[model samples]
Target: MNSLTIALDVMGGDKGPHITINAAILAINKEPRLHLFLCGDKSIITKYLLEHHIREHPQLTIIPTTETVAMDEKPSSALRNKRDSSMRKALDLVEQGKAQACVSAGNTGALFAMAYCVLKTLPGVERPALISALPTHKENKNVFMLDLGANVFCEANILYQFGLMGSVIAEQVDGITKPRVALLNMGEEDIKGSDHIKLAATKLSANKYINYVGFIEGNDIFTNKTDVIVCDGFVGNVALKTCEGVAQLVYRKLDRFLSEHFFARIIGKMLAPALKKLFKSMNPDQYNGASLIGLRGIVVKSHGNASAKAFEAAIFEAIKEVEQQVPEKITIALEQGLIEETHTE
Candidate 1:
């Protein structure tokens, strides 16, 4: 395969361009066929590159943008006031076909607002949905969930669209032939959940393409029983944050307990490799880079607090989607469904 081009929004993350430059260098070293166009203040990026002794690599290009979207800035204000922002410039590369994908560890609201205006959506999509892979109990696998705080007021039909978008994502990214789709709900029974969720379930069950595996509760998301879980942004965001909080609490307690006792400390040393492996597998950073799925071109949103390793994962994510042609897959699926299935309308 030819080298894939990825645009990096260096100024958006909480850690700023230094971390982005480090991550990009790591990504380029790992993937020989990867080319990066770093968009930010030219001098800062150049200083980092020279300090890291990688000033003139053939795989890197720097696109300077004068403005940056602040972490606390409102999305609408960022859109109206910061037209020349790095986030917007990186997105412009995708729209102009200069790059295959763009990765930003920036403000989610700003990314979505700019992306909606710039690249628009894939055919038949009401709007783009934010989705990320979650590590599951199955070991070495992750569950793809959507609407992680993008559209808080999604309708029954919009939720169904999330199912379709998520279905394509799981299939392409995880190689699931027919991903087991489920609606996030209060109970597993058909009678549970709000009317919107129930309606979406009904829609998914009738759609021949989706696996539609009944309904799954919050506790079931990290299990292998379901492959793709769909929910409105409000509920999905809460469920995601709760899981993250609980995981952090458990890890800290285990670390503190191991540190307090001498015999326990010795045992921990003996089991250090296994424990380290287990914790690495469960770290949320391993699952960074939630794609703003359904965009006309690929756009990935990395967590603002991502470390170098986590941010590199985000770049790899964009590469994977570009290779698998996810946007094309979703577009073809939607176009065919619209033509052959009149019941959809």
Candidate 2:
């Protein structure tokens, strides 16, 4: 139980204080040395803390913040106007060294803005990208995709940096000594994609730091063809949401089909366990949450619709990141000039 304090934005997300508070409790229970600084309405947190009989844990602290950055608020305006918001307060904690990391299910854009503005980025990092792990069928192998709505328009060099940063995360977390990297394109051929990707492919292929695996189509994302997939934020976000929508549709269709007939219903019951396991494996919440890589400290963004379990998982994910010293490792890699230009024929 390492003494790692995480500042949590309690007022953020659809679930608000209820799910966030409960998840904090769950994290504290799991790790005794974990201290949580809940930033939100103090009264709300106090009421739940007393009701849950979690009194005087020494590890739990509540910071009073009255305002909250709404999900729909403009990131720039929110950051400029709401100085006392819970999200900003959480980032302040990280900057002040009071917390090792910050966790939020709040406004994605606002969170990213606050992180960059407060904590800043490491040297050689042009922009801090949002990286998340998606479930894959390969055993002990999960796929990582980055620029997930962080930088909508990225340069060729930026995409190459995403690959390098993502590869470091995969190797550290998944134990992949030499993680395979790929450029996300419409086709696998060399002459596919735009000028951005064409230039990126050249740079990634020429760089010796990462194991470049040429180009990968959107369909190959889950086929274990590559360990890390790099693309601009706009494209990556679209791919992520599309996969999520398709998964939900498949589940709904299966449910409807199974109940259409008595025999099918019986078979569904018999196969429920396996199906549940498969679904669980594919769910995004089970893997790493969105990490604000390239920043000085750890900052994780959970799904706005995340449940108590998902929040708990995000806390542990942050813990693993701190324990692994990801930021330090990346800083070393950057200093060594491991991120270089690559060219593909």
- Per-residue CA lDDT of model 2 for 20-60, tens digit only, reads 89999999998988999999988888888888897667878
- 325, model 1: CA deviation in Å? 0.7
Q: Per-prediction RMSD in angstroms?
A: 1.9, 2.2
Q: What digit string (tens of lDDT, one per residue) describes model 1 on residues 1-345?
A: 447999999998899897889999999999899999999989999999999887698889999999999999999999998888889999999999999999999998999999988999987998889888787888688888888878787888888888888888888888889899898999999999899999999888878777789899998988888889999888888877777777778778887898899998888788778765665545453446788988899999888888888889899989999999999999987775555345654
TM-score of each: 0.95, 0.95
TM-score of 1: 0.95
After superposition, candidate 1 runs with Cα above 4 Å error: 270-287, 339-345
Q: What TM-score does candidate 2 reach?
A: 0.95
Least accurate 10 contiguous residues by lDDT in model 2: 336-345
Per-residue error (Å), model 2, residue 113 = 0.9
Residue 75 of model 2: what lDDT? Answer: 94
